[model samples]
Target chain A: MGRVVSAASAIRLDDVTLGYDRHPAVHHLTGEIAPGALLAVVGPNGAGKSTLLKGLVGTLKPLGGRIDRGALKVREIAYLPQAAALDRSFPIDVFDLVSTGLWRRRGLFGGLSKGDRATVAEAIASVGLSGFERRQIGTLSGGQLQRALFARLALQDAAVILLDEPFAAIDAKTVSDLLELVARWRAETRTVVAVLHDLETVRRAFPETLLLARRQVAWGPTSEALRPERLLEARGMQEAFDDHAPVCAVDHAA
Target chain B: MTPYDALVAPFVEFDFMRRALVGSLALSVGSAPIGVFLMLRRMSLAGDAMAHAILPGAAVGFLVAGLSLPAMTIGGLAAGVAVAVLAGLLTRTSVLKEDAALAAFYLLSLALGVTLVSLKGSNVDLLNVLFGSVLALDDDALFLLAGVSSLTLLTLAALYRSLVLECVDPGFLASVSRSGGPTHFVFLGLVVLNLVAGFQALGTLLSVGIMMLPAASAAFWSARLSGMFVAAIAVGALASLFGLLGSYHTGVPSGPAIVLAAGALYLVSIAFGASAGLVWRLLPARRHRAA
Candidate 1:
């Protein structure tokens, strides 16, 4: 029943269950992502949002069931872990960090070719870091560091880009700029899946969405999947509106 | 004769003195890069441990076979690599910290080596192994040092980028398509080889001092990798030359003399070098007052 499909149908997860040390985080999750789609995964704290991305990226193995791609290899996927995941004291420049993306193309001993250098420069420019090639990574600000990591992702030139909470602790301007870049990636017919906590940004940016809270609550277009009833169900609230919770405006287009 | 003239005259006339000076310079240059990586990986103690572990292997070679430097060197390298690999495996499999494993391997090796040397009927040779005599260095030792240093430099130059990447971002390197296993082993092998080759001149105890001190001091001056490598080599070569000359004039042990010279450089770097040094930090404060 598995077959290579068009760009509109790229990743398919069938009955996938994943967890850490036998503790199930995501259970019986079934979904499919289309190419050129901007999908946002949203939930509250400890909602298995990051764990689902880890399972998709092959960093964390699935506990049961199968995660099948139409015809994609693991290397064709690019992952941007949390900003705090990196070692700041490491003595590497922006150029060195970005060049690591080319490791697959230029084996271990092979030097960066002229073409590779051009791609590196283009990727740096794409992230608005044109003159940051020689700057040490430890010297960058939080926003600049996030952009530098985005530059590395651009250099990876993969089909799917998976970002885990890249917008956290960043300023509003940087958030908009990063989302705009993700929109551009979608324009190029690539897949963009981000683990986001801001529901407002999720509604404004991502067309399709997955609402997760230890289990798959809803998986469909943002307008249909992020309804008030579904959100209340996912949040484990009997009453729809509570004094502490903010009201959700669910679009009915889907 | 003036003290300067007396010291200068012996270095010019003595062939053994010339060999000792050149041999120390070559060994310092070869070992410093490996030391840089070792410090970055927080495996500086492992390098120290492996250096000490080679002594028992050397003593065994000397006791079993004739007293041949090459045979001793080969035997020592084998033992050092074995210790490094075992420690690495233990750290991976067990709940032990890397430093704990290193300490255990090194102490056991040292005790075994001393016992083996005592069994060789000449415990006095252990002193020579502990504190080497540069005056006793011969043409064969010079040639061995030169050849090993050249091979190490060539290998480092070839794998420089990958090794640096591995040191800085091992997880990222592992996520990429290239296999990091072989490169990791090659880097470890280079460290083992440098330790074994330089063991004759610096001895086990002081070899790590020469390897680590120069690179550690150089980091205070430069942020660039190539700059750090160049600065480390300069510090190492200068320390070796001055230490050799000072030992010849003052009748001191060559190993301690070299270590003292390196320690002096470290002090100077900490006090005066730019970037991370105390002097640089004080400059902004002075500028604020002056402005």
Candidate 2:
């Protein structure tokens, strides 16, 4: 674990292959992310962008090789999965949900101090949910719910922030406002890894990119990583990878 | 006689009625909050599963000790926890879902309890185990109720925050703290303990009613968890009182009477509760027209 990462590097995946039940979603990926560097994991769908993010966040263990979290301890990294993974019907209010970001410091069963409460309110205001402080989370629209989740991430203040498709299928205004938060996080020198598919947005907002199609295609400046030919090759590679047939006697999944 | 006389006179006259009221009240205070969490977490049926699971343990106690309170209680707690843990394990280790696994285990327990009771006991004794003898609660049963109630309240107060976070977003809680897994198990343990507490007052079949119906009804009224907790306790206490009174007056079985009273509250709440009730949902449009 020690040799796999360093304090200078925020993350190092030494030929890591992430999978479920031994079938690789992300296979044989080697990369070292420097501290304070923002990397956009650009990929086609099913190209293991989320699987890679989950591996980085320590939710999924690497199937082969290793992923050293560098200077980030498990708690120092904040990962937000897709909204569908969250239980929206949960009977919690906006204020309390945002306040849970302070969990790393306060732990479970600890109450918020007066200053901490003010910070939570400020974070809520930052996310444009001021009047919704008391609203039950179940009642919020998808975009508003994302804003509330982003408010929680703001309070987390982790050294490493990982977001899985935070801007997918939402209003443009929400995407822009949340993109601003991402930019602010980068300015603060936090290592931010975002799984992004919108090519134009990725090209405009992200400086560094790692384009993955089950394995590393190209990783460097966004200008080189998202070149048209590389994207076409990624598409071809994924399609060809899917074309191979492994026949089974029954549909076990069904 | 005035309405107050009709309500108050029975308790004033009968010492057994007074004792029954006290026992049910204690059951309400301890178990209602647990019910609220179970409802919010969508583990309401899990509480019922645990309630049924305690039957075999209590039946075994009855078989061995022949109507001793402590023996039955110890047996009930053991059976309840065993079912909870086994169901959890089955869900984890097998393809069976949590609900399916729990249903399988509880049904097995119920069948076992019934068989055990019938083998060595009379029909009257079997009836007592299935529907409790709340009117006949002795000093030992009263002491057990008080003890369980105290333990439930103290444990809940300590675990409330962990339990709430676990309910809302277990994955987030896991990312943040190491307490998530332990909190979940401790909560299940509390569920078993609370079920065992309520079982003596309302038998295995009826005990889960007091826990779930009040909480489900409260969900229609309060959007906030804290508010729902308070609402559930109030609803439970009212159900207990009214059920006890209904039992005394109409000659209905006490345990089922209490459960039916809670069920009645649930139906009323579904129609008239403030938050998501049927009538409540209809009121806004009517008010707008009037305005």
Candidate 3:
């Protein structure tokens, strides 16, 4: 049990390879993420973006890699899986759903303290769902449900947060509000990593990016890594668009 | 006859009938909450498997300890837990699915229990064990039913929040665990313990039906967990009382009678429950059109 020093790099994955069964999804990848930075992992469908996020949170163990952290145990990582994976018919109120994040602190056989309740309230407020605590989760719209999930993660009070496709299928206003909240999270100096599909949003909102297509194609600032030629190369369409100059430089810093 | 004479006569005349009614009511109340969780987790069939698995243990206890209720119940509980743990471990470690493992173990236990009873030359008592004879329940059996049901209810109340969380969202629990293994095992153990205790009143053949049908029917009427739990208990208690009366007058088996009552309630729920049931939805449309 190592204590995470304040303001240290949150995650480090070295030569990681992961897949379902024997079919490889992410082949030999290496990356390092710093604290207080929002990194967008962008790729097309079936590009192993979700797999990478799972690997980070220790849900899907990598077949081969040395994944280390700077004194921050993986339990300090909060994850918001895609909303579709949730059972919508579960009979729980919004507050109870958010309160699940406090499960660890309650320990075995311990009840929720006043401090725990306060944190839950703060988490709900942070997600702009203060007065909706008693509402059933089933009745919430897609965006409100997502916010409730985000509130749960906030209650976790983790140093790192990983989200998989948090913006998919959500309305435009919800996308903006969620992005605004992510920016606030960065301002609070927590590490935020999201798997985003909208390239334009990624370019505008995320400062750093990791572009993937079964392998690490580019890693750098979002604007530099998301060049049209690099995107083409990552998609394995280099032969089809060979005439265009490779506009982005691949950084070997990772 | 007056209503008071009819209601009070059943209790004053027969001690065995009084004991049977009281014992079944206690068992039904405790089993309802356990049943609700089992149905929610989609492990309704596991309850069936556990109920049947208790027979061999009960038979072995009877042979060794001379038909002592406590010895038999302890043996049955141990066997039920063993089979549940084995099935769970097999599913995790091997390629077998949980349902397949449960089915395999269920059949094995049933066959072994029958053989064991035959070896002891207690085939008559085997029928008693298979379909409980409420008339044969003694003071000791009644005490055991009351004791076990009370203990199970207390344990369930203590661990209510964690158990419900585990059923509804296991991912949240996993996110907190380093390996996410032991917490899951504890929940599964609780489920096995619940079914084992419930097996005393509801026999192997119909215990699962008693445990699941009430809860499943309750789901049609309520969208909240607390509401479903209350409704399930009400349904279970009513079924137990009605089944006891039916068994007394009609000479039907108590276990099957209770199950039939529960099944009837389930049908009514499907027709008239508030949420998605046929009558609840359809009648409203008709009334609106008429208006």
Candidate 4:
């Protein structure tokens, strides 16, 4: 029901080191996400999965390296952070929240035409939330809220979509429904990078996988990257870093 | 005096009371929605800070022009916007949190205001600056208030969608449109302009109460943001009406009387208003959890 975005855009990271306060969160990572690839970013807690997404979205610049956003404008990226990051108590209805996706084409004060309203309604139905259009977002349960967010993303209709732990604390039915939407995006050749914990779902749905633990541990087909030994090694590497480490005096990366 | 004499006679008999009513009504029309946005943005205290921040600028205007309306209004507008802008900048660049930066700037502004007013005038003049002269609003003050109200309503209507998007999902808005920055500054400008207008009627210290309290009270009755906006303006107007009567009958200070009336309304709404009122909590099914 949403507009089709152009395919054939790749994202490349050249030795990117992302961090806060000069203390590296994701260090010395180099990789390329091929055009239209559905990649799952799998890592343990503190493995910098979210940090890498932040880098790709241009929210946080690499402390050392370059990210070449090939063929895709920075505005053509749709990022869905963890549901917890959103303020649920905010007084917004589902329809208005979804319509925010039109801000690019319509602009700040742009009036919504009847056609725009129809498009928003179609996006809401695509996410299985048609009846909840006027419902306040705060009243929704966790699954419903995730559905609303997906509706917003559908309205966004961007080329590159990044989802950070979108399935956390959600029910199985909602997970499957959202997975179907992701599959649809893949069929349309839109690049989808999701930070996921459920390895089984990653193996079943994602074609490519990127394992990160303060660095690139592995990047390949899901089968190759999701091996038990590789997963264990990534977890160990993430946990080994001291949580209380002070800021480094000098950045060793040139 | 009977009830009619107490309530209706003051407004009907005296031109001053009528002028004060017009002044506060204009203030309510503009400032209430600004207050609603502030609460939505979690900037209520920052709104207070900006309110006090206007004082030094208005005092500068007062000193230069001897209680002229336009000078003080312009001065207050500049000061309020400067503080909002500076606080935003400091929060983005430095380690200072937004709340901390706002507190620091407002305290400095308050100190500057006190110093500026004391430099030229006696305590009587100081009283007017701090407490305002609602009953004595001359033609210029009335004109300023009405003009600001018109400007504020027009600006808000233009920026409505963007402003709401900015509050709910700023990250999404930033990704989709470049309008976020200009929308934000415009909203802030309106806030400052409204504060400058409000200072003429309610004074710096008590003016923010008129802006915030009714909006906060409105939240108890309305479920939607738009509903809350209308309810807040209505509540602000109602408070102004009765507050003037209270001042006329009881001889309490006018500005504080208005604020205290709003506060009382807030309390009543918290306990008995429709949306999240305390009466719902006392219902049997809900009372089981409390028990």
Instruction: Select the stronger candidate by TM-score from 1 and 2.
Output: 2
Q: Report the lDDT of model 4 for residue B47.
A: 79
User: Candidate 4's chain A scores what TM-score?
Assistant: 0.92
| For model 4 chain B, the run of ten residues with the poorest summed lDDT | B282-291
Cα lDDT computed for each candidate against the true fold: 0.79, 0.85, 0.76, 0.86
Predicted structure 4: lDDT: 0.86
TM-score of chain B of 1: 0.91
Error of 1 at A56 (Å): 1.9
Where does model 3 sit among the CAPRI classes? acceptable
- Superposition error at B69 for model 3 (Å): 1.5
For residues A1-254, write the lDDT of model 4, one tens digit per residue.
43355675689988888988677898878889987889999998989999999999999988987999977788889999876466667899999888887777787667999999999998889889989999998999999989989988877778899999999998889999999999988887788999999988999999899999888899999999988899888978745556687654334434
Instruction: Report the lDDT of model 3 for residue B185.
Output: 58
Per-residue CA lDDT of candidate 1, range A1-254, in tens? 01222353478888787877656676678888877678999887777888898898888899877888768887788888766367666678998788878877776778888888888888788778889999998898999989888877776667788999999999998889888788777877788999998888999999999998877899989998899999988888232223453322221221
Give the alpha carbon lDDT tens digit for every residue of A127-163 in model 2: 8899999988888999999999999998887878889
Off by over 4 Å in 4: A2-4, A238-254, B1-3, B285-291
> What's the true lDDT of residue A171 in model 3?
84
